[model samples]
Target: MKNTPIGRLRLIGLLEGISYLVLLFIAMPLKYFAGFPVAVSISGALHGLLFVLFCLAILHVMFVHRWSIFRGFWAFVSSLIPFGTFVLDKQLRREEA
Candidate 1:
């Protein structure tokens, strides 16, 4: 899956999505409820990196595949919502196949 641009994008998207979830569900709670600011600090940093990578990967795939703006927009949007990337992955898998 790492061999192709779309595959790489899919992988990055999944990673980014998971990181976002961790930051929201686990890290934030740890910071506010448990008084563990470090959890948010670490998870936030990782999620930021992953989010950048995900955007770059999306650009790379868009250029490589010559995808339409709407498609790229959806790809970008998918990274924002919880479990959104998983739903996007289903469509991406169809394209890959």
Candidate 2:
């Protein structure tokens, strides 16, 4: 891709969404139900990294897109909750399309 702000945001959104799904649906279950800790730790770390990237991407998008404080703040805040990035992705896609 061209690495435009929108592209970067979408990329982060994908990473964040997929990682979130994997960690929640697969890793967490394996850890808590199946007693596998290592995989969960690894997935958790990956999710954390993606989450940080997603947050930074959101901030970068805000400036590049010239979003108001309301949009920027909400988008950034949403990342803290599970599945929030996916919702943000929908919004971002709508804006782009």
CA lDDT, every model vs. true structure? 0.92, 0.83
Per-residue lDDT over 1-97 for candidate 2, one digit per residue giving the tens place of the 0 to 100 score = 3468877887787788789889989999999899999878999999899988988888898888898899988887777667887788787777777
Q: What is the TM-score of each candidate against the true structure?
A: 0.96, 0.85
* Candidate 1 error regions (>4 Å): none
**Each model's number of backbone clashes?**
0, 0
Model 1 over residues 1-97: C-alpha lDDT tens digits? 6479999988998899899999999999999999999999999999999999999999998999999999999999999989999899889989988
Model 1 gets an lDDT of 0.92
